[model samples]
Target: MHEPIVEFQNVSFSYGSRVALQHVNAVINKGDYIGLIGPNGAGKTTLIRVLLGLLKPSSGNVRLYGKNIKEFKDWHKIGYVQQKATTFDATFPVTVEEVVAMGRFAFAGVGRPLDHHDRHRIGDVLKMVGLDKVADRRVGELSGGQQQKVFIARALASDPDLLILDEPTTGVDVRSQHEFYHFLHDLNVHHRLTLVLISHDTDVVSTHVSRLLCINKTIMDHGCSIEFLLPSHKHNDVKKNEQIFKRVRHKH
Candidate 1:
């Protein structure tokens, strides 16, 4: 079997005395588009934080690209588009191009001048997100959907092997959501970029993702999308019991 791009082995995490995750073991292979789905407070965000190295597990191990998470030096290898309302600054005067160029901050020295290569990279990313015409427009001036695309463009500027998105379609119109999903499909299929998406729209996500991880406190299920969508045998048993109860009531 091919080695996984990201691995979590017997991982556990806690906040104060409450356990957020418990003995979670998962492996994500290269070029896999995975959907992480669960209700609120089910530790979806916690898992993402752990993967991003922002939070450490209390026990067990997390490896990225065959190295310990702590030792992984290539941060730019993963692109992240956080929940729409989390990081966008409506009052900021930065233009769309400037926001997209922010992805290069890690490569460019702080307070140092940008070179020709940096400008070209920024331009390329802007065009990729279809924001070239609005490159000079202030981010606040654009619609919510446009702003979301800009954030996506910013992440793509780094040309990451994997893209992790947290609720990328939140608060957008139905049409906008459809467009974003098509863009993601293109990125994954045409460009071979892996995607890990955390979303509440289970039906929509199931259509695009190759696999599904149903997380609630821990991993409830991880497998092909079809298996994830099918009602489990346990659920079928419950339905059978309900039917028996209805028959008994009608006969009485």
Candidate 2:
């Protein structure tokens, strides 16, 4: 069995009187690629914040790599790419290499210059994401798709074991979306990196991610995508299940 990388035990969170998450429980195992889907205002982002330790759960516990979140200090082992991460000012003068170098600052001290090893890691991640040729180009010069890769490269520069991306392809072109997902597949298969992709593109997500986690304030469903897509033994039951899933996955 795969080891658990993240575990939420009876996790619940609230904003004053408003409950964002209630009694949420789930386990993300190593080498699992999970697609998180939900409608708007479904507490998806809140769940992520709680997992990342950005928010304290009102009642429950979270564990990272078998240690309580409060005691887990190996943050560099996880990489996060936020929504529309490619929307930076096009006129920014930073080079791709420089931007990727930011990921190393966590290993290298803040305000401290990157050493030889840091520079090597930056080059490796740029090549891994196929951005080596454009390493010297200004970030603004790249297409939206390429800019998105730059952020992914930045995340990988830390050699993180787990990667979490939130709506990564928000405004990219169709072709870029294809390329980005292909790279993600490669990373998961070849590198054995655990991945959590939060997206609303149910059609595309179902095809790529191995597991599906559907939520709306709480977990509506969680299982292999194949289980959700394939028909059950009884035809009527299959139709009924599909209808229920459609309702939960309403357009967001």
Candidate 3:
């Protein structure tokens, strides 16, 4: 079941003349829970954009599910929940179920009414996220944590195999954040979802994820989260590893 899902080969990206990422190489396998951590302006978001096919790399290749991202068309199989759900307009008039139903548009097609299967999927995802009670409630009325869950449900409505979240806990409370990570853990272990989480909270990420991919404009380190948290002396390149860990820990 550990099949390759995402592959980055000698990938490099730039913004104008400023280099964002350089010669990055990594493989994310199916059922892997990976925490992607880095400092501010560390090219973490750039790498994600490249993987999502939003930005073309200056050099090298990105493959999603063994297909070159350029040719990959099964976008619904990959779900993405972007940062800052609380920042969404509170006045938007859509209901929670409506919002989640939007995720199925790719399969349902634009200007087309949702079929029974699509409606059932929307309900299943909402129930999966524990938001079935609020299905008919307006989305803007929900709390920040609930709003985050709604987005997660929206992403899940597509029935994606791989889920990617960018700073998902930004506006959530501490208690909610704790519960949120537990929910993510359940998705990874029980549902067999492949998760790629990008977060600034190193301690939280390290505790929850199976593997850690540390980066700062390059592939700084890649290994099990336990290995990453080990004492400096245990590493082959102790100085570089410690520095990268420190930079990630303190900066953000």
lDDT: worst 10-residue window of model 3: 222-231
The models' CA-based lDDT, in order, is 0.79, 0.84, 0.84
In model 2, where do residues sit more than 4 Å from their true spots? 221-252
Give the per-residue lDDT digits (tens) of candidate 1, residues 1-252.
665889988888999998988888888888888888766677878888898899999998999999999899887989998876435567889999888888776556478777889889989878877899999998988877888889888888877888999998887788988888888888889888889999766557766777777776788643423233333424566664454334323322
In model 1, where do residues sit more than 4 Å from their true spots? 86-91, 221-252
lDDT of 1: 0.79
Error of 2 at 118 (Å): 0.8
Residue 111 local lDDT, model 2: 92
Per-residue error (Å), model 1, residue 239: 15
Pairs in steric clash, model 2: none
lDDT string for model 2 (1-252, tens) is: 989999989999999999999988888999999888766677878899999999999999999999999999999999988887989787889999999999999756599998898999998899999999999999988999999999988888888999999888988999989988999999999998999999766657766787778766777544324343333424557665675456444421
Candidate 1 lowest-lDDT run of ten: 224-233
Query: Which whole-number lDDT from 0 to 100 does residue 39 have in model 3?
Result: 64
C-alpha TM-score for every candidate: 0.85, 0.87, 0.87
Candidate 2, after superposition: displacement of residue 170 in Å?
0.3
- Sort every candidate by TM-score, greatest first: 2, 3, 1
- C-alpha RMSD of candidate 3: 5.7
Clashes of each: 0, 0, 0
User: What clash pairs does model 3 have?
Assistant: none
